[model samples]
Structures are given as structure tokens and as C-alpha cells.
Target: MTSSRSETAYQRAVAAFKNPTLDLLHRRYAPFVVSVLSVMFTAERPTVPISDAHVEVGTFVEELRAAGYDLDERTLPNGTGRDICRSWARVGWLVPQITDGVELYRLSAQAVGALEVAGRAGGGRAKVSRSRVRTLLESVEQLTQSAETDPALRLARLRDERAALDAEIALIEAAGDELDPIDDDQLLEDTENVLHLSRELPADFVRVAESINAMQRDVIAELRRDERPAGEVLREYLHRGEHVMEATPEGRAFAGALKLIGDPEHIDHLTDQLQALLGKSFAHLMTPEQRGELRAIAKRVEQGVQEVLQAQRRASHVITTQVRTHDPIRDREVDELLRSVMSGLQAWVPDSRAGDRIDPLRSLPTAGVRHLRQTVSDPRPPTAPAPLRDPGEQAEFVDADTRAWGGPNYAELEAYLAGLEAESFDLAAAFAGIGDAETRRPADLLGLLEIAHRNGLVESAEVSVVEALRPDGTARRFAFGAVTARTLKVESHD
Candidate 1:
């Protein structure tokens, strides 16, 4: 190769390494990240609620810390798991999405690729197996026969396959019940090979989905640019929307996968075949992981297909809606203004200090006004001198009205207590004996207690209940320590 070619290849390699997939694996804490992600996400479960992911990641970190792992500030992320996840999102390892109105963390295509490599490295499969070679040979042979232009060559290939099948049939018939079965070792190897191939499907699906999303974003951006007429732009975008699944290589693969697994019968056939395989005598030789992978093959394919379809639908919907409500002129104007502002900030950033402040334009400046009032009239009263009213001329308050709203009638309660026969009586009973609703008011209870204390009352631990009436005609029951008036006396009216 020429020096230019070598440099070009090296530059391309460097660019590839800079991608998130390789960058993640190259990080210092890559093992930690991979282990956490692998455990948190699996084939059956792709997304975790944002809060749950944060908590689980935090707990895992704590466990690592307890396990004596070197997770210092330099070795580990600087903040809590939430911050770490946000950082991962910024670096494109995790994609934040909203599903069912809940924010979730899903492995991005790049993250999935990293995980796939990590998982394969630890899978303990043979470096090269007969099953792997056979699969490649069969695939290439089929491709060759399918691509053959001459009908004679195609017929010859079909004849050869038929001859081989006839021989196998004859051998089986001759063996009768003694037909040879595949060895457990070979069976396990083949299953593992199949699993190895299946593992790439999820990452491929994610790539397609992400590609479609990216295409939508690009289309919208181009529309906003208004470089072309609206009709022309809409036509281009509409065509993309209709053939969204064919927009990218990954999307094209997704389209082919749809042909294979989109049909219910195909999925059912795959499931049946898997079940029959598991029922074989050699199946027991496979690990639980292998068995599980085999069982979920059909389900995983369906899920991946659905995910890609949903992504395509989402893209179409977004692109269509953007086209319908598109205002190229306004969008272009806004885009230009934003670019200008960003350019200004970029220019100003080098001269700005960390603590520099700018008063944000929260609202338009107030209109200029002249001759505004600076002071108001004084709020003080005009006069303050007033003599007290003569007591004789004041109208007397009615007793009933006074009893309803005023504080406890000490004099009334004292007279009522004097009317009681026993020098010592339960305060509750005395208060209850009063027939006047006003006198039996809740406030009157306090008055009775105060009057009892003044006239010498004995307190006991025994409980007491007093039902008092309010002026609003509602009754309230209060419970307190028992109070018994002793040597009750009336005050002088001096």
C-alpha cells in the first residue's frame, strides 16, 4: 500500500477508536462499567427506570467499595451514580428516553456493542469450531447458488443437494432404528455458535433504531435551513418517511430480518425447532445460559423487530408532523438569531472570568416616564386629643349578650358555687348541674376551675368529664383531673 493509503487507514482506525464503543472499553473503569451494565440490562430487559438505574448503580458501586476495589476519585467517576449516569449519557454510552411517561436509561448501540464484545470474551467458546466453519460454508454456497445467472448451474447445484439428501435418506432407512445421532460435544458446539451469532442481533437492531432517529433529526434540521423550496423539501422528507427502513445499512438488515421473522409462522417454526433441539439427549450437556439463550431466540428476534418498527413509526410521525407545521422562514430566522447569539458567546467566553455575571433580559425595559410621584401625603391622623366618655352615660351591656361572648363570668360562677350544698363537690357535677346554657359554656369550665382554686379546691388523680355548651349551640366534652371545691367561700362585694 502507498504511504497515503496507510495514513488514511490509520486515520480511519483512530476515528473508529474514538467512537463510544471502543472508548468505553478503553476507559480505566471499563470492567466496572461493563459489569454493572451487563447485570442491569439483559435481553429480556432493555430499559430501567432512571431512578432505579441510579440507585442500583450506586448500590453496585458501594458493593465494589466494600469488596476492596480501588474506586478512588481518579479511578472512578467523580459524583454519585446519578451523576455518573448523566456523564455516561453525555458520552453517548447510555440513552435517556421516556417510555410510558417514565424516564428510562437504555443501552445505546455503542454501549451494546461494547457489552457484546465483553460478553463474548468471557463466553469460553472454542476459538474455531466445526459448526462455525459449516455455517460459513453453507451460507457462502447458498449465496453462490442464488446468485448464479445460468439456469444450468442452478439445476446442477440443486441436483447435487438432492443426491446428498437421497444418500442420507438411504442410510437412515438401512439403519432403521439404529440411526446415528449427533454427539453431545458437536451439538453443544453448534448451539454455542448459533448463540454467538444471535448475540449480535440486539446491537444491530439498536443501531437501526438510532440511525432512523438520526435521519429524522437531519431531515428536520435541513427543513429548518430552508435551502430548498418547501414543496421540494417536503417531497424529499416524505420519500424518506415512506422508505425509512431502507435509509441505512442497518435499516436494510432490519428490513431483511422482517422478511425472515416478521411472519408468525416463521417465529413459531423457530420456536418449535428450538424446543425439539432442547429435548434431545445432548441438550443436557449445554449450560443453563446456553439453554436459556436458545429458548429466548424467537422472543428476542420478535422484540428486536418490534423495536425497529416502533423506531421507524416514530421517525415517520416526527417527520410528518414537522412537515405539516413547518415554517421555514420563521425557523430560519430563529436559527440565524440563535447562531448569532452563540457566536457572540463563543467570542466572549475567552475574555470572561468564571465568576462573571450578566443581568439577564427578563423583560423589556420599562417605558421612560417623567414627573413621577416621589412622595405621598402623610398617613397620620389629623387629631389625637379625646377625653374618655362618662361611665354614667354609657349604655349597660345586656347580661345574656355579655355572657355569650365575654370571658368567664367569675361572679356568676362564684354565686352558683355558693348555692351548692356541699362545701366539697365534684367540679364536673357542679358545672353540669347549671341549667343555663351560657353558664355551662366551655369558657365557664375554666372560670369554675379558677373560682375553685381561689376558694380552696382539692385536686385528685381521678378522671372527670365535663360537657360544656358553646354559644353557637354546639356542645364539647372535656376531660381533666378531678377537682373538688373545699370550704367554698364568696368574695365580698366591697
Candidate 2:
């Protein structure tokens, strides 16, 4: 009797061959199927339970028909097309059975052996789907057609494909060019031919151009590092029949690489070479100032080198020394002495044509002192009398006793004299007393007469007493100098 498991397995196998999804499942399960068959065939009894076979087949198919393979849908095989069960049987992998009127199929022992052999050969898996094969074939055909019909596009594609060719060429050319002009270097010849071919060729030549240019740059950079003049390098490159200004990678790389290195010596040499070249190429191209500045920079560099050498010597000596003493006091003393000397020198130095001159007596008594001394020694000679223009203008001068005890409304003058009691009695006090009087007549007359009698305000009158009488009638001699307006001056002396 045919078991349900065997019947189910046959039906599943047939379905897998008919349906596209099932077909993908079959391909996925083929490895497992082969593995199981190998185990079965290796067994002396050569028998695999229908349930085990069915489980193995289902698991393998499910895995093979995963989303990764895009094999979800199933398309049924038509009547004339191949189906799973018939295909397996025809391939001698399975045999049909009719037991108890129930149809079933089982894997034949010979079929299992064949599967083992096929698995060993790594050919047990099914082939790819027909649709995918067809798509790939169609893509190849379209690509070929496009290449044939569109020349420009095809050339662009080629340029993209061979982008590095130019850079390589430029490198070879630049290196060959740098060698002392060779007679027949194949590399140089080849480079020239490549350049010429690239110019005429229809395919994109940018990549080839770039590569050659980069190679050229590398060559120039190497030469520069060896201390060759950049201009000389460039000139030699040009002499080899290459345009330095064109979009050649070599030329650009050479210039850029030189800039990157930035060696001062190389820059100086190159600058001079360039100037010379420019002079030859375009006479009167550079200004005199430009030339001068370049020379000056060179001179500065030489000076800097000398300075560096000297500094290095000093540094070496310092490094070798063992003594370490820091004397702040000594340093300060030296600084002070230096400062004094500088100050003295500055003092003696004439600031203008007038020479260093000193004021005659600016350091003498200040205004307050001089005023005090003058006030004490000689007060203003009363108020000086207005000149006696007319003899009639002269007012009669009266003695103190002759004058009224409470003099002519001189309250203000008396008050001023009272205030002067605290001050040093001198010319200023005398002047203040007389000037404050309500009656200027007597004061003015007295001041004029006193000035005339004493000859100067600062002079004192020497009074000699004939005799000093005692109350008992005994007498003695006396002498004194009175500081009065009698010793006054109308004008100050020089």
C-alpha cells in the first residue's frame, strides 16, 4: 500500500517542476535532495523513510524559494511542458508505484546512487531560471549595439575607462625629458607617440592626458628637490616639445609640487633663472625695483645664515659652561650707573642753538619770602604824593600834635592800621595805613617828602640822639636807625 507520505512527496515534486516558484524551490532543495540520496545510497539497505525524505524536501524548497531569490510566485507548466514527477522519473531519480489502487513514487536505489555521483561532481543543483538568463543575454546584445552606433558616447566611455593613461604618459615623458637629451630612448619616443596618438584618437583622452601630466609633475618635483632651477626644469620640459601651459598633468604637477616643497634655496635659484628667462623671452618685462628686491632677499638670506652660525656658536659655548650664578644686586647696580651717565649726558646736551642755559636766580627767594622781607625792611613810603604840578596844589602838612585827636573822619584808615598790628610792619604796612586814609592830602605830601629825604624806600634813617635825659636830670647818649618813610624811594632799582 502506498503511504500518504510517499504520495504527498510525489505530488510536491511534480508541483515544484510545474510552478516557477516551485521550480526555484526545487533548485534550492536540490543540494539537500542530493545529500539525502547520498546517505541513502551509501547505506547497505538503501532505504530512507518517506516522512524523513518529505521533511528534508519541504525544508530545502522553502529555503531555496526565499525572498532573496525573488521566487514567490508559481506559474504552472502546460500540458506539453515538463513536470516534476515525470522529469524525476525520466532522470531515473524516482519510480512510480500502484499499491492498493493508491499511486505513489519512491526514489530508486539506482537513482540515489546517481544523485550521489552528481552531488560529488557538484552538479546536483538545478540551473538558473530562463527569464534571468534571457535578461542577461539581452543586456549584452544592447551594449554591443550601443557601442557600434554612438561613437562619441563610446569614446567618452573609453576615456572614463582609461582615465589614468595620460598621467602615466606624462610621468614617463617628464622623466625621459629630464635625462641629458637622449639620442633614442624608446620610452621618450613611446611617450611622444602616445601623446600624438591621444590628440588624434576619437576616444576620450583626458584620462591619458591627466596621467601623463601627473607623471611630468613628479619628474619636475624630483629635479627641483635635486636643486635644479624650476625655470630650467620647465624649459627642458618645454624643449622636449611639451607645452607647459596646456592642461597636461605633468606641467601643473611640476608647478604645484615645487610650490609645495617651498625650499628657500631652490626658490631663490628658480627666481633668478625665471628673471633671466623672462629677460630673454620678453625684454624689459621686469621692473628695476623687482630686480632689486630679489637681490635684497638673497643678501638678507646670506646675512641670516651668518647670524645663525654665530648664534649656534654662542649657544654651544653656553651649553658647555657649568657655572650658574644669578646676581640681581650687581645687575641693578650696573643699571643705576648706566642710568646716571645717560642722565648727565642728557643734561649737558644742548637742546637748541641757545645752548644749555640756567635761569639767573629762579632758585632765589620765592614771591612770598621777597614780599615778606620787603614789607619788614621798608613799607611803601606812605602813598606817594602826586607831583606838585602847581605849587598851589600842595596841601599844608601838619604835625601829629597839631592834627585833631580824632583826625578827619579817618575811621577806615584807623581800622586798617588796627588790622596791621598782627602783620610784619614794613613798607607794605606803611603803604596800607596811608592809602586807607580818607584824606589823601597829608599822606601824599608826606610820602613825596620822605622819598626825597631818604633817597630810597629800602634805606633807613640813622638817628643819633644828642642826649637822653633821665628823670633825675642825669643824661646819656643814644643812637638808633628807624625804619620809616624818610628812607623811601619813589622808583625801584635794577
Query: Per-residue lDDT tens digits of candidate 1, residues 375-490?
Result: 99999889996988767446576654443766897878878877777768888888989988878888899988988888788888999998999888898999999998864666
What candidate 1 gets wrong by more than 4 Å, as runs, is 4-19, 71-75, 329-333, 336-357, 365-494
- Using lDDT as the measure, the top candidate is 1
lDDT per model, in order? 0.85, 0.43
Tens-place lDDT per residue, model 2, 1-494, is: 66698899999888756743234235533544465445443212223344444555445445554634434333222121124445555655655544345554554434433443454356334334444455568689668757686788777767865777887777788888574543333333332332222222111121222234344555445443545544565466444434432445534533353353346676478458545543442324434633343334333333323322332343333322311332345655777888998997687675645554655645656465543333354666868888857553455756433342222334443344344443334443354346423333334333433433443333466542223233333544543343433332124369
What's model 2's TM-score? 0.15
Clashes (backbone N, CA, C under 3 Å), per candidate, total: 0, 25
Residue 258 lDDT, candidate 2, scale 0-100:
38
In terms of TM-score, the best-performing candidate is: 1
